[model samples]
Target: MSHLSNHDLPRLKKNLAGRQEHNSLKRYIERTREREYIAAKLSTHSPIEVDTSYRVAVRKTLINPRDGLSMKRIIGESDLLPVSYMQAGMKASKSVCRIEIRDSVGRVLGHGTGFLIAPCLLLTNHHILECEEAAQFSLAQFSYEVDLNLMPLQIKSFRFVPEHLFITDAKLDFTVVALENDSAEGTTLSEFGFLPLYPESGKALLGESISIIQHPSGAPKVVAVREKKIIDVYDDFINYTSGILPGASGSPVFNDEWVTIALHHTGVPDPDDSSKYIVNEGVRISSIMKYLNRLKPTLLEEQQVLLDSIFAGSELANYDRNPMVIGNLDMEWYERSAGYDAIFLGENYAVPLPTLRPDLRRDVAKLTNGKTVLDYTHFSIVMSKSRRLAYYTAVNIDGGHLVSVPRARKWYYDSRLNRKYQCGPELYNNNDIDRGHLVRRRDPVWGSLAKKANEDTFHFTNCSPQHKNFNQMIWLDLENYILSNTETYNLKVTVFTGPVFREDDVLYRGVKIPAEFWKIAIMVKRDGNLSVTAYLQTQKNLIRDLDFAFGSYKTYQVAVSNIEILTGLDFGDLRNYDPFRTITAVTGDIEPAIVNVINIPSDIRI
Candidate 1:
């Protein structure tokens, strides 16, 4: 090495006298636009436009020059604590665990980390045990931390009890699990103290140090000190600056006081350089706690007591325990089967809501504009919030004199159901798909309520995504044939129509286009027969590589019992009255009757 001369020393002193600086608006705008562009791409919305105000915000003190960080407005600057204090506190708590997700052969397919939140409960990322097979056979090893001399210690392994109470949400990305009170080695779970969840919502602040105790790559557990800084905090997640490896997933991120702040989940690579990770991500602990509190009532008494103890001395402990249903829809009448008065069975019976599957989140609310329940007459509809489609529509059909109401081309967005909540004209714009009415326009037209019921069927909530050919040809043909069947005589017919919402549905233009539709028609025949027939139609062939062009759709007559199994809705006694039930029993082979396209009306079993 060569010694520095007098010239070199003077130059270095002059260079160190001032700090590095740059003032380029173009550079600033370019960086800001790049970040916003990435955010818009990640989101479902359209690309964001960087306006003048956004540029000013960028030029102002929005980003720190030293570390290129922007603090959350809600988080106070005083929330950060010293690194030494945080590490000591977390070491004393000793709550983190090593998780191994195994396959059927007892071999580990993946590895993750976890932490105890309650006496017999562990909180981790949902991806660790997303599937039933992995969740059922996963192993959780506690006390895997390094000893005083930095050597491996005796670890206690615990098997997961997924069947008991495994609550997980894909959007939130969390899995709350209840561990056995005793481990495989017969060690009490209470021996390992759990890191208490930070009760307050904004407990973790941006730019503050975060501590993590994890088993990186499923190696022996070790403590990582304040090497991470929280970058941003949202309603459900906390983005941070840290280098978390694959096995570090589900690791507990703690504050200075050892209060669990977040559960580590993901990482973001540097945009300019993909090889280096820029930030890590975690599911906020506060959101997880709220979900756990909501699911507390369904837990065992022992689990409840454990949760109570962990949540003690916090405001969340005394929070309301009421489980509120969405949209305040009364499910009592909807859940009941053949929900109608027995006395009015022959006259003018109104069909009630079908028993919607509880697993599907259907936020059914009364559509109210300027009318009461009476104005709706013999028709009722329930809408699914997530699917943006009708769960089902129930209508009473009078086969006496079919009302000659002209088809109203006037399609209005049902203001009764919030405009944002319904699948409006945006989905059908420039497409061959029609707003197919579940309660056919003329189905509910009867008696003195003919005019009002006909108008109510025009509501958007009663509509579903249907191809023009499927709706006009097969669907309408089936409806007209059933009503004109001579067996109807003067009897009233009730029909329940709905879309089959499968998880793997084709998503198009922010809407999930259903592949199949189901309709169950019930009526008292002329021969005093209480006949029930269920029909299914598929529009999968109509959609070729997302090009939803008009094409032929096949309609099949399936058993009413099969509808309950496929839709997970309880049809109750309706299955007993199916005309195909006897035919299926006689043959000792359960199969759906395919409708013949050539002879549509005669093929239907009455």
Candidate 2:
């Protein structure tokens, strides 16, 4: 045989490259046809959302595990009708894409394939985005496929939403990151028909024929189907014979119905021949979901909504948070007609309201009147419209009715109140002020009414801006300690809280920052006598010298009567039951004792 001369080397290499490209294009076309066939068959029998036949097949596979079948057998036996399958493939193709991962300075570091699990979320391999650094500089290229004319490629690129969520798990080798809601081209990710993550596992089978839509070797998008089969299934991993190359790391593995089953990760190499591969492996979608469920409750409202879509069949579907409307829950009511007054048993079966609401400000501030009275399951509030803050929030907690629900920090603007008059996220964002819930989240959470009350506290009308240090430390401890030892109050306690809106309060960003806040906790004692203790916490140090950063706050147990005088809001008959009433001086003001970390619980006069 004659070896090629130097002159022929260039031609030979060019011919080989052209051949490889041709083979890739051929494989992509063939798989695209298969994907469409499956989708079309699916559309004929059921609505897209509820594919009963697909579910039944998955269920059957799980009930009786089977060995892998030959590619010929799998394809020859496919029952997908061509027309419907073509429609389905066309629908699903929009979701699968070739992703180019770039580093800082816009240089492409690597490439992979990712699919949308939610409108704003893309699921990929952890190895593709290992850390915040990787996420900070990466770009997600979607629709990187040949145009209808089959000459030029069509693609949309999106940067990661820097201020959004980027969660990764190396142990599971999966990363779920949020894409910018819209690309620079103004195309929303939702318009792409993003694939929803299958919450449950009855959707994929042991011997199912799977297809991988991927950007193999960082090349243009391709669908690898002909040789794919789920050879083995482990608890955390699945082995398949899908055709993939180096850059197919995060490609989605889907069943005939276009439902995602697993995330393609790595391929096994043939030990005898290093150049060839044996079987490819992927992280099980079910396993990825288990990890996602652990994070749902803790995510922000928008994030929870995204996660809820993935695991919609589970409890997350009814997630009541709406990002557009600040603090709006789907349930229709400020009061659920569930009668929260019933919990205020004994002498006062009714929640105490402020006798006199905060006087309208006579200052240079704009008066957009948001002062709206709203009622929740376990609490009520009289929000000060002019000040854009709550005048007072009254809450009745049946200490005996405790629900160990973790606090859901889902803040919102009360819909009943005008958004302009409400101090919203703008005031709290990038500032030292914490959006303090005047009606503590856990206060109203009891029995069946817990969820509503927990949700109620998120409204901006029921929230006030307090120093972060003050809200999280002694202030929070006081609430928690009181609830923990509820037996002291016969398992029932009522709290009245609000900011001390003095005219001279520090002004920050057009909103008056209250320097002080007060809380009065009332309960029926063992003797059936009403007992009330008042406490005041101040973040005066934050703005005293124009040093408006968060600093330590002082807590003092004062007379309830003093709180009434200082805030100009009456605390009802609770003033007469104050434990510190006798401690008042000749000036009619009870001197406050310094409450420190050492005696936060004991220092309280209660």
Instruction: Give the whole-model CA lDDT for all candidates, comma-separated.
Output: 0.59, 0.62
Residues 238-290, candidate 1, lDDT per residue (tens digit)? 66675766457778887544557788876654556646655677777768777
Best by lDDT: 2
RMSD to the true structure for each prediction, in A, is 24.1, 19.7
Which candidate number would show the highest TM-score if scored against the true structure?
A: 2
Across 1-606, the per-residue lDDT of candidate 2 in tens digits comes to 234343443354344334433433333344556545545653443322233465444343322111223222333454343354456566777877666656556666567678877546788877676555666667888777776677645578888763567778876777888777678888766567566565555555544566778888777777765357665555677666645676678888877656677888766655467566666778888789888867765766445444544442222111221222344554356535332352475654444566663244332123234333566777776666568787777777765444534335466655555577688768866555666667766668777878767777778777777654453445555654554334445556777888888888988888898888888777766676776777887888877644576566677877776787777667666767776666543442345352222234545656
- Going through the candidates in order, what is the number of backbone clashes in each? 0, 9
Off by over 4 Å in 1: 1-344, 347-352, 361-375, 549-551, 582-599
TM-score of each: 0.40, 0.44
| Alpha-carbon runs more than 4 Å astray in model 2 | 1-331, 335-343, 348-351, 357-372, 406-410, 483-490, 545-547, 585-598
lDDT score, candidate 1, position 61: 21
**Residue pairs clashing, model 2:** 36-85, 36-86, 37-85, 40-84, 40-85, 327-412, 370-385, 371-385, 399-491
